[model samples]
Target: MPRVIVVEDSPTQAQHLGFILEEAGFEVVLAPDAETGFRRLNEEHFDVILSDLHLPGDSGFDLCRRLKADPVHRNIPIVVCTSEVDPVNVLRGLQAGADGFVTKQRPPAEILGCVRRVLQRGCAPEPSPSARTRVTFLDQDFELTAGREQLLDILVSAFEDVVHINAQYRQSAVALREANRKLEQRNLELQRSVESERRAHEERKRAESHLIQNEKMTSLGQLAAGVAHEINNPLAFVINNITLLRRDLGYLEAMLSLYREAIAPLAVGRPELVEPIEEYAEKVDLPYTLENLGRLLERTAEGAKRIRHIVASLRDFARLDEQELKEADLNTGIASTLDLARGRASELQVALETVLGPLPMVTCYPARINQVVLSLVTNALDACKPGGRVIIGTCVKEDGVEIAVTDTGTGIPPDVLGKIFDPFFTTKSQGKGTGLGLSISYGIVRSHGGTIAVESTSPGGTRIVVDLPIRPSPTAAP
Candidate 1:
């Protein structure tokens, strides 16, 4: 029978939920608060947990969060039973990692339905072909098939051997059996342990990477600002020179035209004056010099424009602001990030393509979100070779917005896929990456009630997707 744990502070409420589950043919375990509920979970297996929003010590949301953080318990679907059904409360419950939420005022039938659905979905599946087969000496090598009595008799007889040998063998058998049994318990616990360790390691690495990247970016930003200032000075002079040169050319052209007109009349009236004017024109090389000067001014103007654009891009990239959540256009952020990545793209000779769809305005920190988009785009550019393409697209989903950045480059290895988002995890050469970009981005997206994931092919490239929830205003209905 499926086991269910009902955690509520009120004895009557707990009993009511337990009774409902018991009547539904479930084995029910009751706890008055989060502490006992969690203790029971660690001691035994339960298919699902029905938790009240308010407990004595820790709230239901906290319990759900703790459980989700533990891999071993994370998968046991938690249906939050709460009186608070406000949008903010529901959002908080989801963010805290509850699998489902049902109001405490809900009918018993509704509660039962919720419990049944959670249990059916949360139950662990049978071992498959690829599943690891645990081996234990007691179950694998020994034959205890006769009966429990026969097995006990065999054990007693076996113990009559050399004392040291019998003790060693029995100890080994017991240890192996215990290990196997522990391994066979609810997978959520094991998952929780592994995930917790992995996240801890990742967090440490991310902190280090963030420190390093910030240092590098700070230095680079200063250098860029200085260089831009220096270039602006020279460009100012160059542009001025072009303007002066253009004026000089215009004056020379006007003088030459006047000379041509004067010569046309002088040929008949003052032939001698025409010769002197022709001589003057030959000495100045007026035609060729004017043409060359015009071209020079044109090229100089183009160069100055290019420098101005680069300087503007650098200024925008270096300007950091405090984080604030507000309404933002995803397309506008992408555009800014693309401009900031121009230098990187130039170095890689990669092409960028964007196909943006209508997206609902999402509340977020613009600068931080821009940083994430830039990091992702820069990573994509670095991963690809010349002639490769990076495609960024955005669209609105039913629940929120989705942004995807895809690159046609050397794809990630399957073995390393899971670790890509881990901090300090990089496939790049030393000095090329700090590796905190994606990890930090992952955290940022999660903080906004969103998720970030990646997909990649063996020989193709990688695509990173980000999803953000649409937060409605308080006055809005459910």
Candidate 2:
């Protein structure tokens, strides 16, 4: 194997050259500068020296001149493997006595071929004095003292490489322009497709949103009416009981006034005066009045308490004062929802059953969860006909709590089941539903990082399960 020394200022380039030469069965020594290259040459006889034009201490051009000046090393071949491909650098390398000049851009095979050719010529005798020529290039004067044939060979080979590289660059430019045109055309088509789809999606969202708002208004009206009914019954009985108590008090007050006037004037004969008071008390039916008054007061108090309970349930369901997330009991929300829904359940003749199990406190928007419970239970009740049953239950789960609403009524059809959660989709008759209930509930659950799903068999019944994390995700919005 022929020994070659690679001198390159860049460590990476030196390694690359050394690897190529060694892979081709040459003994390669790497040098990071011209000084190192000379040091390596002194230690061992090298057949070829591959060097870059730029170096930290001494350049490749300087190395070429010094080597050619030395009598013993002058015969060694030097190849200037540089990235500088200009005519100026080529002339300078040749004038400095480089045996052959090759650009770093040349393929490995071409570089290897150049090196082999230079090695063969290094055995030839030095060029005669008459063979040297004085030449002027790029406005600089230079004498080419290297072998005439060898100089011409290196120059011609470099020129051919430059011409080949230019042709390749021209072809690459044309191909790149064509690729760019196709990419631009494809981008325009994709932009148009995306815009059209965007408009359609926005239109659908707007329509669904309008329907959802209308449904919300309808639900609000129904809730108001139901709450009013729940309040009015207790209020009416309370007023009636107060009226009866007032009339009995009036009779007793008149009898007491008559006894005071008659007994004060005749103290010794007050027994006869007491007879008139007794007769007046009998006319008023005082004993019956007293007995009924106590009952009326008790009934009035009970009615007042019922009214207060209805109001409290309404407050819980609305959660008007609470907006943000808080540690709340899901069971409490469920109970409140049931309290508000009991009236509707009674009217529908649907038996409302509960199977409440132990549940953990969940961090959530209490009002929204209450709304979810109400929506689910109301749907369950609506699904059932007379004598049907709706069961609402809650239990603890691994990471959270689950609420399940099961109803014994007509279940969803298989074809429509998948679309149930889709906005504005419903099985109810026209004007009966806006169909955003379950969709809204789904959104609420998703916002809480929870899941809600339904299980149903046609004509058998439907069970909707809602799983809520004990602690909602931080990103959850009220």
Candidate 3:
């Protein structure tokens, strides 16, 4: 609570001000003159002082000057209240350093308001606006009673400025909140867009890799077809000529037999013809040659037939002109693939063995199945060391046929075995492998309505099994 001193000569007026100050939670002290007021001030501290212009001794103006001049009392605010509204009296209050001048006729609320402002402003110097107006425009006529309104005006203006600043702050707060909300929304949207793009990028890359794999397979099919045709043409003529040579040799041998029988009788009389013929027969080993000539021709004919069979398998496996599914023997396809991979097996010194079980013809894409077998067999050969063995076997299944390629070599490591079918993952060094063989083979088998699996352990060798449906599903067939 603030403390105030009342230096009024009239008890009624002084008591009225004291009632208002006391009601407003201030400690009130009363003195009738400057002398008594100064004594009370000397006894204890007071926050504000109220005094009357006319007093018994040393009036309010003189008290104001004296108190303001004192180093100890100068900080306390002094307010002058009197019926004297004359300009000279107001000017005298101003010169004496009075903090404020309020007429005794003013309302209690306005008086209390002035004291509140004075307390809030504290010990700062507040020059009287009315004093400045009087000094600057002395020639202008103005009523002294109206000067108090100027002080209220200054207080009202300060309150209005505070209200305006609060309103502006509220508006800025609302704008900042809206901006933060929008920024959070944009950040979420950006995150979603980034995730979507990442998935799309991955899908595009996979599609690209699949397309390249398909294109290579198609080109390879074409090459195989052309090679088969070139080999078949020459093979036909070679077989036909071998057949003719075998027949002519049979006729010549029969005639030679007849001549030797006739020469047996002529040898007693005319030995000249017999001697030359016998010498030629001895030099040529005629007995052994005649015995083996028929068997040699048969072997040559068998070799020709084998060559013809291999060529036919190559043609069926290529299937360059055939796009639709057809009846195919898995055993035959495996044999064809084995034939194709034989060169690689030979180079790696891996023996190729086949155990083809009796299997019914299944409707399938023969060329694609052959490709899968070839890839599997080639991989097995690659895994083998010198003198290693690769076995390709086909067996009958309840709903499909199984082709398995087993190799006797170092097995696939457990850690890498899982990723063997993943695109671009490989254990083979550098350019030795593209890492797409098993991945493409997996896709091919799936497209054919089949499943392919591998089994291997460290140093135990590896076995790959392909289980293909006897006939592709109606929806799966192309």
For each candidate, what is the lDDT? 0.74, 0.82, 0.80
Q: Pairs clashing in candidate 3?
A: none
- In terms of lDDT, model 2 sits at 0.82
Q: Please report, as a residue range, the 10-residue window in candidate 1 with the lowest summed lDDT.
A: 142-151
Clashes of 3: 0
The candidate with the higher lDDT, 1 or 2, is 2
Instruction: Specify the highest-TM-score model's number.
Output: 3
Model 3 RMSD, rounded to 1 decimal = 18.1
User: How well is each residue in 1-478 modelled by candidate 1, as lDDT tens digits?
Assistant: 9888899989888888888889889899999999999999999998889999988899998998799778788778787887644545554665565666666655677667656655555533322434423323433322111223322332332232234355667989999999888877757688888999989976777667666656755676677678778888888888788788888878978987876776787789878877877888799887887788789789888988877776765655544432346677778777766877877787889998899998878877655567678888988898899999999999989899888999999888889988888877888789988677887777667667778999985459999998877763333210
Worst 10 residues of 2 by lDDT: 209-218
How would you encode candidate 2's per-residue C-alpha lDDT over 33-88 as one tens digit per residue? 89989988988999999989888988999999999888888889899987857778
Query: What TM-score, to 2 decimals, does candidate 1 have?
Result: 0.51
* Residue 230 displacement (Å), model 1: 4.6
TM-score (C-alpha) between model 3 and the true structure: 0.55
Candidate 1 runs further than 4 Å off: 1-200, 213-248, 263-289, 321-323, 358-361, 457-459, 469-478
- For candidate 2, list the clashing residue pairs, or say none: none
Candidates 2 and 3, the one with greater TM-score: 3
Off by over 4 Å in 3: 1-205, 270-273, 355-361, 394-401, 424-426, 429-432, 470-478
RMSD of each: 29.7, 18.8, 18.1
